[model samples]
Target: MTATHHTTVELAKLARVLDRDPGDLAFLATLPPEALREFRDQITDLTARREARRMQRVGAAAKIVPAPIAAKIAEAAFGPVLAAAIAGSVDPARAVAIASALSPVFLADATLTLDPRRAVELIAQVPAPMAAAVARELISRGDYLTMGNLAGSVPDSVLRAALPHASDLDILQVGYYLEETSAADRLLTVVTDRVPGVIRATHNAGEWPKAITLLGLLGPTERSKLANVVAAQDDEVIDGLLTAVEEADAWDTLLPVAAGMNPQSLQRLAQRPAMQNPTLLTKVADLALTQNLWLSLLPLATHLSPTQLHTVAARVATEPDASLTTLIEQAHTENHWPTLLPVALALSTPDRKRLASLPVMHRPEFLTAAIKATATHNLWPAALPLLNNLPTTTHDTLATTINTLTDTEFQAAVQAAVQAAVQAAPAADCTATLIQILLRQDFAPRSRSLTLINEAGNLETLVGTITTRDLALWEGLSDIRTEIPGHLRNLLAAQATRCGRPELADNLTAT
Candidate 1:
């Protein structure tokens, strides 16, 4: 690279290191090549000489005195400045010996002036209280880069003492730059009792995006611990973090932390008002599926508003079978089948049929549990769509489970359908669904069929709407419910006379 370009690059790097702005300097292109070379050479030589002198001073200071005498003389002479030089110059073992001999007050004072690169190597030897006082000094000075450098090498006891000295800004800045993330996590673990203070500090700093990004560095177990901390914050703080993520377009940064949240924390988050936004929920659903976070997310689904629950359920229903299956299994395991029913309802016809036929779904336990959940939660409206879509084999499997339900369970499932139909917002579809489940030949109980036909509004539309193949579906219910045969005989006779198919009408009674 040209001398001018190299100089500009080095200046830019230095600006970044010092956290200073390196503004536009297109003017650098206009400098004469010869002048640029001379300037660059001078700066380079100056930098080299300064570094050489610092090294020479380190050597000179190490040889000047015995460890104890040097510690005392340095204390008396340049005070913090002399101690700073010793901290920087002496070998780590010898520096530790000298630190032990020095007073905590002097060490705390020297820490303020000591270069962090040098201080980090020697911090372990300092007493906890002294280190804490130095940390307070760093926070007061806003010296995050130094804290960042020291973070990994410091012991938990030292960091615990020191952390109280930090502000939220201090925590954020140090967390952002810490060289060893695992060490930073260790520090966080040690000071967990102070997590709320840390959270408050982070919020006060308005560094939510940065804070969440740093949270992503921890392992799942560590993140779970912090998740509880974040959850304990007031609603406004949680809302602000979400708003910050939205404004910054930082969903990627929030994902891992979200994935690691404990179930209770996930529940609290899912129930937040912000989670009601269809757009936000869609984004969450997309990320949850993409990241395979169903294990974390499915439990939260139980807490969502019906509308939000449906929205998420719809998203999962459209996912590939493996993702959908994982979600179903988790919901079932968590006893969240009441929640899963709505998602199942949202699937396309073929997917619904596919789900029903999956061996897991067909398990007698799942089938009975699903039926009980539907009845218990009044979820017939949500489940009707799936029941209607089940293939013949799945129908028989479900029918077997339904038949095993006690009289009360059977009545509850039927009553759930009746109430769902009565209360259905737009009554047309769910009433037909109730009719289908009650009269489907594979699953019908004779008594429930009789009450359903009498109570459900009308069979004319339901029966007339049935396709040619479903005519047999209608005929098959006759033997199960004595009333069904008489009801069908009247309907078919009226249909046949009206359509002028007297031969078909006569055959209806043959069954």
Candidate 2:
């Protein structure tokens, strides 16, 4: 349940125990549910104990009268509250007989005042048909608290008969007010096929917080089933569900269910048009950071359009460094780099730099995992920008890992870098960074690496990077001059002269 709804449920129960309107006890809503429940239980126990002697006397008298007469006297003289108070003290069989004789309306009235804990045996013995009748009466009166209080104590046979008379909305409301999670679970089991209708009813009624609370009360299997039912709804209903969760700030309850859904259902939910709302996406991103829900969230995020994914990336960029570090570590641990790398690529240059500069990004294991994920997912196109921004401290580790890539992997990285350079503006920092890292490493197949760079036809940007960032890179090219095809050597030498680096140009042409 959302925290607000949980507190409201507790306050209502507490109000009933103290005989106060729920509004009068609104001040207690800030207290935790457990605290409120404890206070309610103490008051209920004290009240029942204090009234035990008088109620016992009444019970003894009711036994002497015949059941039919006792029912009349209790309704006419004692009233529902007094009648309920004496019920626990009566013999279980005698109580059942008396209840059977009373009209359903009167029985329903007494149920409102009855404490199920005190009358468990009597409630259990009531005939299923009679229980169903009282349930119908309570449903008509919208007395869910009374129905919820007694729902679990009655046998499953009673629920089976009684629940069909209640609409989906009625079931949801009663589930909300149910005092026991086990009761809610039992109720869900009896009405498992009604989940889709209940979800639609909840959406139509704007009762998502109640539905989310109900989801939390079920076991994993039931929760997944109900979540998929919600997922299967059309965009309008699904959007309504998201809006309600946002309004209630109830993502904590909804996210786990979203995470646990079967793959097809999860993808359907992820691709909904409502999932692209920037405001909602921002909130969910923040929640994921705080709750360590990235493992759950990333899979869903992968299904968003490029535009929508960038919205999420922009939000993630605003998080602090420590938060970014946690996200990176989680991505590595969960092997979610394939999912996260795209978001990193989508970040603005400055934000990408911030992500790359995280301390965790410098760790050998994290860098290795990132490289492996890039190779495995064939994600080098997206990985290049972030890799380009990584701190120089990590270059050796990155270079070591990159050099270990198989022939196919190495060529893919080279092709991706060349493509990034060709596609980027003149600065081409991504390709430049890759070249710089390669130049620094004891890269094997040096001839093959240099050959790929020469053949890729992006020498102007690479040469400019060499001149501005590290002129010594020209000597590395000089050493591998044989790998440079003659025409490409002329192209690089001419571009170098154009940049007024004639001496460096001499290195490419001389050998």
Candidate 3:
């Protein structure tokens, strides 16, 4: 693997003519300097002569047959075999001119005898109608190998008219081996009406790999049609398809279909055991993130295990903020709380913070769902900080909600709030805010004691501040008189008086 050096002049000509890297000419690497020069000269001469002979053959064919009589003379003397040879040698434009006058049926027969490579060049010269006829003729004979060769080069109108005449199985086989995928994709639109039959034929043929490959080439609507066909089959059939795709390592081909499945269909797919593989699930998650398919994927993700859900959450957490927010909004709008919460819970702290800040969180329904989710998942420790970070208005709203909760739910909320407060520690702004809001209302006894006795300082400071802003907060201060300390009582009295609530200040001082 030692490197060799060459002057710029040595490789410039050979590189341009051969279109190859001079370094790949490994045989040249060990040769003496004199041999390199001789070898380069021989290669250049050979290329020049080969190109000259090809042109000379075209020129000779042009002179041998006048355009008007070419078809007649070709058929009479050369027959289909020799006529194809003559057709293959002439320039394409001249071949096209002569082909226009020949019978479509005759050209179709002659094409059968032409070399496939030459057939590719000349097929493009024939009119769409004639090519259609040829395709029909070829398909009738089950000559799919020839049909497959022409698949990439055939005109749309030709394939459109001829494709219907072929059986579903033949189209599947031919379409699979098409030299150009784009051409096959275009042809698929023509066979759109036959997709259900074609899918069945492909499935029965046990050519699941080809079925998946063709499925990959379809547009969303067409792919959906094929997917419906897949969805209509029995579980055993569907499982077989999944197993085939797995064994073929064709997840890359199958994932886009999975990504676009309707919820019911996706639910079916998610229930399949093959989808439980961590490796496959991780790859699917990667597709979800890269493809902005989280909304579609989220419903299906609900069917995965906690361990699998964590993989999805970890991958999606790395997506752009707008995508994450959109995913959350779509989830809430669709009432997908069960799916959304686990993912949100699994998010990293920074990503969770980002999720908390989304404007969607300000909506009442979304906020309540998030709170309920905390209790349902027992994620109080994680959920508490997120709720605490909301706008102060949201804090006020949540305080009102606590009294409305069922006794059991209220207790869970209280326990979560306590844990959040403990975890938040020295900077328990959210805890302080929640306690103040709850204490301002008629909450259950346990919540009252925890807020008033254990966190009395937070409640007192919050009351003084709220009372200063609005004399209304003074409305409920006497309810916790035993819990407020002497200095805080004096602070509240002066604050209440400054807010034009002298009578309230008198009550506070007496307490």
Candidate 4:
């Protein structure tokens, strides 16, 4: 489309708003006089004002976003008022309504433009109710981020139209939400639209987890796209790319992305060693787990903490019919505990106790750093709970290894812990750990009282701990021995069995 008479003036205003170099704008604006008039007419089309208001409404609804995101919206609008429009305080419904009206105008006229980044930022900011409008607008534009971001809200018809036009990278992006939003039907539909080959190209900027998830949901046709994208990247994106591949073992194609994961995830990914035959996936999961990237997996991979890993280690594996201990044993051959231990301890329950039980020499700086960090950040409670979980062997050792505090000093620390414990809704694990210690170190307890078990939030572990011990010591407990002991014995044994120690379990003979 040729520029109309006012092309220079409009171009200058747009350039100023877009914050482009003035010379660049003048150069882009330079057109034949006749062409300039035509372009000006196009720019002033009623469609232009209509579209501007529509984008303006989107900018208006984007007020909820933090300023940085709002700024991105501004940049993406191709000089439209993303920020200023969003801040106007117009009712949200009105803004979306106006924005939808102009979407088709901007979409149909190539000369009538909208920024993909700005459009996405705007779409991402729209309220959930108006999501369809945002999705519809995004579909008309047909950018990768737009197609992807609009996935959840777009109508199936628009989505279908977008599928064929989509490149592999676009499929990965949009497909990510399909997989994550748990829209499996959409995910499968996308797979059908995909051209074969998993293309591993650099996705346009934005967090990539959802896209990675989408990659996992792909069937054969889409995988061809994944292959293509994989062929396009430097190694860093390999983790993301590999993460997607790690989901299913149908290696009808070479697994290129598997090279980038951390040791732990890689280790998990490598269980089907035959498909990802490089013999290096576990090594990468381990390295990644130790590095800061390990934390990223908590939100994206799984929220497994060390303590959680420890307590449910058996169950976690069992539930899935996979044995975690076996994997740990196998992983030990190639992986280092330093990376896995610290993160698990920090985030998982089983790992926390496991670390707390570790001999000092066996522990690494990372473990110490995590513990010291809890202390330094006034997060003593996080560490204090682990103290309860410490095995008897480790409890005795930690006491000695801890600074040579006298009885008085130790009492003071316990008092502090007691206060902290009281503030917390007590836990069964904490009670069980303390009970284990109590059983090992019998006495009229001082600061670390047996009654503290009652205070801990978990009743099952409390009942389990009390039942396993001879309850004869507590007051008024002797008469019920025949009645309680049998029941308690049977219950404790049953609980233990559920906890995965059948041999240790009591053979409940109907009490």
Clashes of 3: 0
Ordered from best to worst TM-score, the candidate numbers read 2, 1, 3, 4
lDDT of 2 at 371: 93
* Model 4 lDDT tens row, 1-511: 1122124334543443355554676765656544643453454455345666774666555656554454444446633343333323334354344444344334223212333223444434454434434344554565333344346544455455545544555555455433123343455555553433323333334334444444444444544444444444544454554544344321212232333334444444433322243333333334333332332222212223333333322322222213333333333433333233333334355545554444542233333443334434344444555566554556444433333333343333344454544454333235344334334332334223333432334334335433334322222222222333344445555665666655445333323
Clashing pairs in 2: none
Model 2 stretches with alpha carbons more than 4 Å out: 23-34, 53-103, 118-130, 152-158, 180-186, 206-209, 212-224, 245-300, 330-336, 376-378, 399-422, 425-511
Query: Could you give candidate 1's per-residue lDDT for residues 333-374 as a string of tens digits?
Result: 878787677666655566667876676776667777887787
In model 2, the number of clashes is 0
lDDT per residue for candidate 3 within 1-511, as digits (tens), equals: 0012222223432443355776666555555534555665676556445655654564476666677687776666657655665665677778877777677667666765454454566666677666777778787777664576567676676677677668989888777645444656676777877876776777788877767766665666666656766876778768878888777666555666665667677768877777777787777788666655655566677666667777777787777877766777877777666667667656666777777777788778787876666556565544555665666667555665554555556555555554444554312445444545656554454355444433343434343333344344455565655555566567667766777878887876663
Best by lDDT: 2
Q: Which ten residues in a row have the lowest lDDT in candidate 2?
A: 460-469
- TM, every model: 0.61, 0.74, 0.50, 0.27
Over 4 Å off in model 4, which ranges?
A: 1-106, 110-112, 115-210, 213-278, 293-440, 443-511
Alpha-carbon lDDT of model 2: 0.80
Q: Report residue 178 deviation for candidate 1 (angstroms).
A: 3.1
Please give the distance, in angstroms, between residue 273's alpha carbon in candidate 4 and its true position after superposition.
Answer: 4.2
Candidate lDDT scores, in order, read: 0.64, 0.80, 0.63, 0.40
